[model samples]
Target: MNLSPALQQAIKEISSSQGISPEQFIVQTLTEKIGKLKQSNQTSVSQTGLKERDGILVFETESLNGIDFNELIAQSRQERDLEQMGL
Candidate 1:
């Protein structure tokens, strides 16, 4: 990565003090930092959106499929027959 000599020295010092290799130290620290950054972004995004709702799918058919006009008139008159008979 062409790090500065002083920064490289400092990283070596820290790595030795922590009992870890320099490569391991860099990889572990960067992975943790990246994880925290991703979690922070996800939290903000989730807070902004509304809760979701469920949807229902429905299908329907007409009760009287395709009766003709004369058939409909006859049916209507037959329904009135009982009431008219009482009078």
Candidate 2:
């Protein structure tokens, strides 16, 4: 393929400095980046059931049944309001 003189000079310089052909250097760089990307994209599944749900899920720090849940619900509502406001 046709390459600019500056690019050709750069390839020669890199190849000589690294003791490898320009094509091999390029191939190695592409290979390494691809491997790293693939590794990073691999999401390891957790053995814990933190994400498992049978149906509609609700999250609450404490049940809203007695006086203990009053403050918890208030705090949760405040947090929800803050989230809605993009805080």
Candidate 3:
């Protein structure tokens, strides 16, 4: 879509060095990014302590041990505030 001139120049130089057209390079990069995102999503789902029972998704109680709910909430709020402030 409308890439800046600097980005286009960088892509042109990189693709030329790798002996490929800029369009092919962009396609390859995008494909790799999509593959990584898909793989990450799949792994995250499996790693989460969640399971389906009686048509409902529930977290395993044992997996909740030692978690500091207050600390987590505080950290989440801090992060949200920082994000809102564009830090």
Number of the top-ranking candidate, with lDDT as the measure:
3
Per-residue CA lDDT of model 2 for 1-87, tens digit only, reads 697999888888988799999888778877999998866544322222223257633333455466667788899999999999999
| Candidate models: Cα lDDT each | 0.79, 0.72, 0.90
Tens-place lDDT per residue, model 1, 1-87, is 899999899889999999999998889889999999988876765676533346532333356557698988988898799779984
Clashes of each: 0, 0, 0
Write down the TM-score for model 3: 0.57
Q: Which clashing pairs does model 1 show?
A: none
Q: How many backbone overlaps does candidate 3 show?
A: 0
Instruction: Kindly provide the TM-score of model 2 when superposed on the true structure, using C-alpha atoms.
Output: 0.39
Q: Model 2 off-target regions past 4 Å?
A: 1-8, 43-87
Segments in model 1 whose C-alpha atoms lie over 4 Å from true places: 50-87
Error of 2 at 10 (Å): 3.5
List, residue by residue over 22-71, the lDDT tens digit for candidate 3.
Answer: 99999999999999998887577668966667988777667667899999
